[model samples]
Target: MDRSEKTVLTNMCMIYDDDGNVLVQDRRDSDWGGITFPGGHVEKGESFTDAVIREVYEETGLTIETPQICGIKQWPEDDGSRYIVLFYKTSHFAGELKSSEEGEVYWTKLSRLKDLPLARGMELMLRVFLEDEVGEYYIYEEDGEWKHVLK
Candidate 1:
C-alpha cells in the first residue's frame, strides 16, 4: 500500500468574534501547515461534537458552547484509507484566548481571508462552509484522482 492508503479522522471549529471575524490558527505541527480553523484530531472514543469542543479549547483556550454540526468532508475508500473531517461552529463561547504550540491564534476579518495564506483546500472549504447549506458532503479518490459529490 502506498501513502494514499491511509485513514485519518479530524474535526475543526470555526469560532467567530463579536465583530464577525473568524479565529484562525497558523498551524505548526501538521502536514498541510498554514492558516486554518482551531481544530485537531478526534481522539479515540470521543464523539465528534465533543472532539470539536475539546480541540478548540486546547488550541485557543475558549470554552465553546453547543457547537452546531455544520457538515462533513470525507474521502471514502474500500480499504478504510480515507479522511473524514467533521466541521463545527460556535459563536457563543467564553474564556480568555490562549495560543498553543500548535500555532499562533488570532482573529482576522472574514472578508480579508482571501488576502491571507490559507492551507490547501481550506479556502474552498471555508467558502462552501460559510454558505447556508449544511448538507452532507462526499470527497473521494478514483482512478488516482479526487472528486466531490455533494448532497
Candidate 2:
C-alpha cells in the first residue's frame, strides 16, 4: 500500500507597525479576492520562511524581518490534496510600501477590520494571527458539509 499524499504549501503574513495598525492588501482578483495580507504559494525547493519573505516583497514591496510563525490554516482540496497556509506576523520591517497588480497595499487600524470587506474565512484566520492562544485553523468536510475549527 502506498501511504502517500499530495500537498500544496502557501503562506500569509500580517505585517504590523509600532502603532495599532496592520498592513493589508485589497486584492483585485475575484478568486480568493478581498482584503487580506500579502502572501503567495511556496515554490518548489524553497523553505516556508523564505517563501513568505519573498511573497511579501513581491506583493507588498516591503522587506520584513524576524517574521514569527504565528499559526496555520489547512484544508483538503477536491483532488485529495491538502492545501496549507502558514501564518506569520511581524512588527519589524523596512522599505517603501507599494502594491502589486494583485492588490492595493495599505496600513489600517486593526480595530477597523470588521468594517472592511474581508475575504472569506479571514475572520477566523485573523484569530490565529492576533491571538497567541490559537495557533491553527483547520477546515474539513463531514457529512457532505464543510466545517472548521481553531486550535
Number of the top-ranking candidate, with TM-score as the measure: 2
Model 1 scores a C-alpha lDDT of: 0.82
Off by over 4 Å in 2: none
Task: Report the alpha-carbon TM-score of model 2 versus the true structure.
Answer: 0.97
Give the alpha carbon lDDT tens digit for every residue of 4-109 in model 2. 7899999999999888999999999877889999999999999999999999999988999989999999999999999999999999889999999999999999
On residues 1-120, what C-alpha lDDT tens digit does candidate 1 reach at each position?
556667678988888867869999988866788888988798888888888888898999999998997877787767777878888888989998899999999989988987888987
Per-model RMSD to reference: 4.3, 0.9
Pick out the ten consecutive residues of candidate 1 with the lowest summed lDDT: 127-136
Best by lDDT: 2
Off by over 4 Å in 1: 1-7, 76-79, 134-137, 148-151
TM-score of 1: 0.84
Clashing residue pairs in candidate 2 are: none
lDDT of every predicted structure (CA atoms): 0.82, 0.94
